[model samples]
Every structure is written in C-alpha cells, then in structure tokens.
Target: MTGQLTVTVGKSDGRVTVLTLSGELDRDETHLLEEAGEAALASGIQLLVLDLRSVTFCDSSGLRTFVHLHRLATARGACLRLAELHPPVSTVVEVVNLDRMLSLHPTVADALIL
Candidate 1:
C-alpha cells in the first residue's frame, strides 16, 4: 500500500524461475521486478513465472516493466508468464489487454506446466 515491494525468486518443477511479488508495484518498486527478471534471463533461465497473488497495487510503470521484461525475454529466447495477479493489477492488465499479449495463468502450477 505504501509503495513497498518484495520479490522472492524460486525454482519450479521445470527449469523455470518463479518470482513471487508482494505489496505495491510502481515506479519506486519496479526495479526489483526488473532485476529479478534480468537476472533470470542472464542466468539462462528461459521460462519465468511471476506470482503476483499478493500484490496490492500497481501503476503504469509496473506495467511498463512487465512489457519490457516480456520483450527482453523473447529476444533472449525466453518467456515470461504471469500468475495470480491481484484484482487491481488484473484490472490494469485487462484494460490494457496485456492479458492477451502476455501469457497469464490462474496459478503458479499452471504457469509452470505451460
């Protein structure tokens, strides 16, 4: 709520990186997401899962971060999938139709399988 953010990186069953995000995602916090994604890509992780179930808020900067990550991942022959976006974040994704542009799953398990 106060623009705070946290990112937890973990490995799923497959060779995928799962980033669990909590709290607000905005200009002040997007760096965390960017760093996690970039590090995963740099480390040769082709598949990424972003679990945003605990996210409380997100701004345009957060959206931009996601879009940029998607592009970077693609260029690196990687993929970024999002899962469990909170209501606020989900609304923004839906309004911008990013739900169509990005691979979105209802759960982390679902993203990991795909």
Candidate 2:
C-alpha cells in the first residue's frame, strides 16, 4: 500500500497543542511530524500531544521520528506525549520499549491532563 500521513493541529484551552496523525507513518512521512511539532513549538506551545488513534501503521523509522519530535519539544522547554495509539502501533512501541521512554496516554483527553 502507498504510505500516507496526515497531521492536523488544534488547541485546547489555548495551552495544549494537539497534533492528530492518521494513516501510515513511515520514513518518508517523518518530515510532516517534525514540521508540525516545530511549528507548535515555534508558536510557543508548551504542551504538545500527538494523537495517534487514527494511525493505521507505524514503521521503525516512524519511531525514530517520534524520538526526534520528543527531543525538539524538550529542547524548547516544552512537553511532547503520545495518545490513543493504534493497537499495531502500540505493539511496536511496546516491542521497542518506547512505552517506557515516551509519555503515553490512552486518549487525547488523558494526554491533555498531563
């Protein structure tokens, strides 16, 4: 299947920036995530949440992108967390032990609470 990724940015209470990602996340699409995250941080958003509920699949390169995004958030004194991970993506995260490395929540609401 051809790879696709969509990133939608929104905010809650003007503080938390939510980035909703859907479709397959792969090496070719990592730039989208980085660009969105950079835009959020550049706009002075301290709280960033990555909503992955709609993501159908994620490759190892996608995981690397997440790590880079996480670093970008931290470098600017911001927070980056994952929420509502798809089952297959969740399994990959678990298998790679990213569950322990990244802040993960079951839903966007839960992530907003962080």
Candidate 3:
C-alpha cells in the first residue's frame, strides 16, 4: 500500500516560502508537491524551502520532482532548498548523489539563513 502525502505551507512571507511535506513521496504523490512548489514559485518568492523532516519515504519520482522544482525556481530567478530530510529520503538522495545537485540543510532555520 502506498502512503498518503501531505503538503502544507509552513511559512510564506514575501521573499521566502516554506513547504512542509510528510509521508511517502512516490509516483502517485509527486503532483501534490509539484503543484505546491509551482504555486510558491509563481508567487515570486526569492527563496523556496521544502521541509522534509516528516517525509518517511521517497522514490525516483520524488527526485524528479525535486529536479523539476529546481529548474522551475531557476527559470523564475529564485532559489530552492530542501531541509531536514528524514533517513529514508536522505538515503535515496545520497545514493544517487542528488545531494550534490540540490541545496540541502540540517534545519529549516539553517536553510532560511543561508
């Protein structure tokens, strides 16, 4: 059985926006993340932070969504950062070396400051 994904707007100021995600991020749930990310980018925020401490699992589809969001943020002249990755999600990102390609932080506060 697939776990349900939940995306929540954790913070949204004029320049920075943070989206908190929980549950498994798989093929079936990528769209929820994509939509939330796109909306955050469209709002002209200079920085987009994804807080993934609650996300328990992630698949290739989640990686694709991250890349997609990165590109979108770049095209819109914004920055994307992922924060507080759980072990399962962090393992996937590290094994694939996506950690080198994406901005990652130990905490949402860290992402916000840097």
Candidate 4:
C-alpha cells in the first residue's frame, strides 16, 4: 500500500506519448498516475494513450484522474485514451459511460492507430 505506482511513459511518432500503468490506481497511486499524465500533456504531446492492461483494479479516484487528464489533454490540444483495461477498470469506465466521451482501445497499437 505504501509502494509507488509504476507508470512507464514512452514517445512514439514524435506526437504520441504512451503511458503504461501497472498496479492499482487507488488512493496510494492516483497521484503518480496524475503526475505521469500531466507530464505527458505538458510535453506538448498531442496524443496520450494510457495502457492499463496491467492494472488489475481501479476505483473512483482512478476514474477521476482519467477525467481530469481528458480535460488537460483537451486544453492542450491533445487527446487522452485508455487502452487494454481489465474488467475492474473497464467496469468503472462503462458505468460512468466515459466510453462515449473518451476513446478506449483493446491495445496500445490500436490506440496509436486512432
């Protein structure tokens, strides 16, 4: 519970920043997620893709972070997307119907293609 969340970010095509998050995005880890997301947006990256394939659990905090990131991306003339979400994270996104506002892909490669 005290450990830091692992958020790995990489650049692609000089325009896309892929942030791969592994581990739970709970209260203990939300800050890290937000920081990573903000950093990507701050870098002037036009496309932000979050790879949550390794995330086994997500709560309201995680969902809120995504929403906040979406706004950040929009303000920066960029895009924020979620990819490879496991059932738990996917459920939160679906219940909130964010799928309508944001893009969700089955894989990172798919998101990049978008």
Candidate 5:
C-alpha cells in the first residue's frame, strides 16, 4: 500500500542519534529513508538506531537502501542498527538473511542499548 516514511531524530544519552522510522518503507518510500540516514551523518550524527516498528512493508529497494546507509555509517566510524520491525518486515529481513549481517533489536529501546 502507498505510504510515507517519517524520520524523527533524537539523542540517546548524548551518545547516539536515534532515527525512528515510521510508516511503510517500500520502493516508493525508500529514497527518503536513504536521505534520512545521509542527513543524519551530514549533521554529525554518528551512531544510528532505526526504529522500524511502524514500517508495515519493506521491499528489496528498501533493504538495499538500508544496506547502503549502513555502509555509509561504517565508513564514518559509526553504527547503523535497526529495531522494532513489524512482523512482515521482520520476515523479509529473515528471508534475506539480513539478520546475519545486520544487528536487529526487539525495540528502539533495545537498539539504543546496543
């Protein structure tokens, strides 16, 4: 379904930048997701915690976007972690075996602790 991805950035104990992603993250919404991460880095946000609980769907493009952003964070000596993925999104994450390459937390709170 058509939807929007809203990114809200916050500070986690003055150490990391928490980027909470809400709404569906599909092909149509993936570009915004990529820009959100890049913007965080550009704004000096090192550590990134992506809360995906509100994301109802994520296609290959969305996953690819995440991977690209993850690499960007790594290059900047930062980390990009995901948390609170809905069941559908989580299933795709598992199907793609992204769990093996990326850290997935149960919740945004948990991601912050990582």
Candidate 6:
C-alpha cells in the first residue's frame, strides 16, 4: 500500500516560508509538493525551506521533485533548502549525489540561519 503525503505550511516570516512534509514521497505524491512550492514562489518568498524530518520514505520521484523545486526557486530568485531529512530520504539523496546540488541542513533552524 502507498502512504499518504501531507504538506503543511509551517511558518512564514517576511520573505521566508516553511513547508513541513510527512509520510512517504513517491511519484503519486509529488504533485502535492509541487503545488505547495509553486504557491510559495508565487507569494514572493525569498527562501523556501522544506522541513522533511517526518518524511519516512522517499524514492527517485521524490528526488526529481526536489530538483524540480530547486529549478523553480532559482527561476524565481528564491532559495530552496531541505531540513531534518529522515534516514531513508537521506540515503536516497546521498546515493544520487543530490546533497551536493541542493541545500541541506541538520535542522530547520540551521537552514533558516545558514
């Protein structure tokens, strides 16, 4: 069975916005994230942080969504950061070397500050 994905808008301060995600991220759920990302960009956010601490699983589709968001943010002159990645998500990221291409932080606080 596939897990349900939930995307919640956490905090928004000035130009920064946080989207907290939980559950599995796969091909079927990528659209949820993409929609949220587009909305953040449209709102004129300077930084978009994804708090992924609760994300239990992530596959290649999830990785692709990350890259898509990164590109979208870049085109809009916004920054995209991932924070508190769970082990499974981290492993997929490392395997694909996405860690080098995307901004990753140990926590949302770190992602916000640096």
The model with the greatest TM-score is 3
Q: Note the Cα lDDT for every prediction shown.
A: 0.89, 0.86, 0.95, 0.86, 0.81, 0.92
Q: Order the candidates by TM-score, highest first — what do you get?
A: 3, 6, 1, 2, 4, 5
Specify the highest-lDDT model's number: 3
Per-residue C-alpha lDDT of model 4 across residues 1-114, encoded as one tens digit per residue: 344569987555558989888888888889998998898788888899999999978887888899999999999899998889879889888999988888899988898985
Mark the regions of model 6 whose C-alpha exceeds 4 Å error after superposition: none
- In the order shown, the candidates' Cα RMSDs to the true structure are 1.6, 1.5, 0.9, 1.7, 1.8, 1.1
Q: Return the candidate ranking by lDDT, descending.
A: 3, 6, 1, 2, 4, 5
Off by over 4 Å in 5: 12-14
Q: Which stretches of candidate 1 lie over 4 Å from their true place?
A: 12-14
Clashes of 2: 0
| lDDT digits (tens) for residues 57-105 of candidate 1 | 9989999999999999999898999999869999999999999999999
Cα error, residue 18 of model 6, in Å, equals 0.3
* lDDT for each residue of candidate 2 in 56-76, tens digit (9 for 90 to 100): 888888899889888888998
Backbone collision tally, model 4: 0
- TM-score list, all predictions: 0.93, 0.91, 0.97, 0.91, 0.88, 0.96
* 1 or 4, greater by lDDT: 1
Cα lDDT tens digits for candidate 6, 1-114: 278999999998769999999999998898899999889888999999999999998988889999999999999999999999969999989999999999999999999983
Residue pairs of candidate 6 with colliding backbone atoms: none
Model 6 lDDT, full chain set: 0.92
Clashes in model 4: which pairs?
none
lDDT of 1 at 82: 94
Worst 10 residues of 3 by lDDT: 1-10
User: Candidate 5 lDDT, tens digit per residue, 16-63?
Assistant: 878777888888888888887887776666578888878878888888
